[model samples]
Target chain A: MNTDDLIDFLATRVEAVDPGRQDRLLTLAMAGSLCLAALACIFALGVRPDLLRAMGTFDFVLKVGFLAAMVAIAAHGLRRAARAGRASGKLLRLALLPLALVWFAAVMQIVATPATSGMATMFNDWFVCVLAIPLLSVIPLVVLTLVLRETAPTDLHYCGALLGLVAGGIGALAYASFCVNDAPVYVGIWYAAGLAIVTGFGWLTGPRFLKW
Target chain B: MSREPDLEALMRASQSGDAEAHRALLQHVSVRLRSYFRNRLRRSGAGTDDAEDLVQDTLLVLHTKRHTYDGSSPVLAWTYGIARYKLIDHLRLNARALRNVQIDEMDDLADVDRYEAVDTSRELHRALDTLPRHFRLPIEYVKIEGLSIAEAAARIGMTDAAVKIGIHRGMKKLAALLSEARP
Candidate 1:
């Protein structure tokens, strides 16, 4: 057949696709991510100590409320990411905002707590939070990375890298909110370290496993 | 509830969690997609079953990943990209199947038609190769790939008018080459 005929044939094949299945598949995929987010929230809340010492009753409520909101947003993002695999541009872009918020809150808590000369105190206060970064941040980062992998164009690799970096930055911000101390230097160092690690993870996994 | 909304607007609303918008968007695009697959099957000598299967697969991908589409870009570009990937995958699978079978056992008539189609296609490709890269791509994208003028224009960063003009000139040259080979 001539090229025109070939194209006409292809166009018809493309036009025949059922949009209903697309919606159903998207909803199912997103459901997996939402389930993950729910489990993560439960683990995070359970691990966190009582709010009685860190902040008063009102302050504690506010912090818990904020954390809940972050989780909700992340859940929404997870759902959206899964449903569209990579089709919806608006939801994909908007997802970054909540993911960033979650990271910001985490970082604040890390920086606000006073540094201690005692090895045990320092380890318990800062190290634990730092350790949890990879586990918690990686989940959402990996999810977004998967979505980006499936949806992103070949020419958008740079944008994808930049997206990883953004994910890292927001993660840093979430870390900051929980920190009691106000040391910008420590925040810069530890947060940057965490960001670099997660960004690297995204870069590595995004290309290989994320390809749709 | 009311008269149907525009597909683009429905997509935007659906992103914001409007159920009606989501339903409307799906209904509007489904018929167009069916037509697309049906036409492809007819031209390629494939059956309706294959076209229907592909249509279902493409739509499933589209619905699940609606969030990946940025409202800023044209909807067709985003959808077309998904469709292209699916088609390529289908072609690859078919090629693998053909490779597994014995080519020597194939009938001559089937072979002749395949050869003629490939031979003519090669001639057209070689003629296309003679054009400058800039002119060649626009023509291939618009004429050969069946992309809308707007999509071809956006992909190559050319204005719609420029893409149209380039395609016109390229087609004229291709036609001249094809006619020359007729004698």
Candidate 2:
């Protein structure tokens, strides 16, 4: 079409633009997907039998909190990625704080405990943790990808990667309740590994699917 | 030449559903994009006709993504961002296609008559036909037939909001289709 014709096409019958529409849509979609992931995790894996008892522990709270923080950061980054020219490298830098904090806690815990005990806790259910987290992430990742296509994202790679992180974070959080390994070292290793897999999935598929 | 502030004001007014303001904003934007694309295309050794297509593609993206403007940045900056993305995308697609040229075809590439003029509207219509009916009808009615959203909604038997959404989504899908069709 001619440029003028295209202009006329777009300018006709314009509606009042809702500035918050994308933000609202993304937040609702993410919330709904996270809820779906949580439910799926609960039903499929079953929550740890001593769930209430686990909630009282320091390591459990830290583990859950770490995942929650990652999700929040990724969501923020995703919001930035949705807008044209708004993506910033600073968000990635900010995310390093949480990474450093979790690793610091893990290191301290490792140093405090005997090497044998720390290593044993770190490997508990490692296989199940990695596999199950990605499985749980499937719903949120797919949902977020679909929702993301409705908005314009220039940095498809960043946007896709953030979606993966958000999905993975939710998956990890859901898995936290069911996980028996509460050691900071275990969380620092196994949980990070699972999240990285999802994030890698996002990074690889981002340029293909997020393009629009 | 339209000043940035004037364009920004037009953008703000356009956001409030003022069709005239939107038209005015887009006219200015089209002028800017034409020159922008022309310069970039010249630099990249691409045809000026491709610039026209890129201008239209970027405009479509801007139209569909207007709500993401947020007004925190200059309107031109936002426009330039989308324009840059379209330019890069076009160049990248061209490069990929160029990579597939056989050594035998390389000899024929020097022929002046080898290229055909791009028929944008025909291609656009072909692209539109590929969209789902729900997404296509609202665009055909409101954009092509020049019907208002309410009128289109009534005829399509969808709610007005649905019609609006359909048009928005249809435009996005159309833009994607156009992008894939880029020469």
Could you report the DockQ of all the candidates, in the order they appear?
0.05, 0.61
lDDT digits (tens) for residues B1-183 of candidate 2: 634548778888888899899998888888889999999899889877788888888888888788888776788878888898889888886775576454344555532122332344346677788789999999899888889888999999999989988987788778776766665
Q: Clashing residue pairs in candidate 2, if any? A: none
The whole-model lDDT of each prediction reads 0.50, 0.82
Candidate 1 residue-wise lDDT, A61-118, digit = tens:
3433433443444334433332222443343344455335544744664566544432
The residue-by-residue lDDT of candidate 1 on B1-183, one tens digit each, is 465456676667666655455555655565566677677667766565555445545554555456566554566556666665555555554564466455653545654444444356435577688787667878788666768778988999999878866865565555444333321
Candidate 2: where are CA atoms >4 Å away? Answer: B101-141, B144-146, B151-166
Q: Which CAPRI level is candidate 2?
A: medium
> Which tens-of-lDDT digit does each residue in A1-212 have in candidate 2?
66777777777788788877888888998889878887988888888998899889998888888888999999999887877867466776676677778899999987888888788767777999999999999988888888787676777777788888999998888788688888888888889889999988998999898887
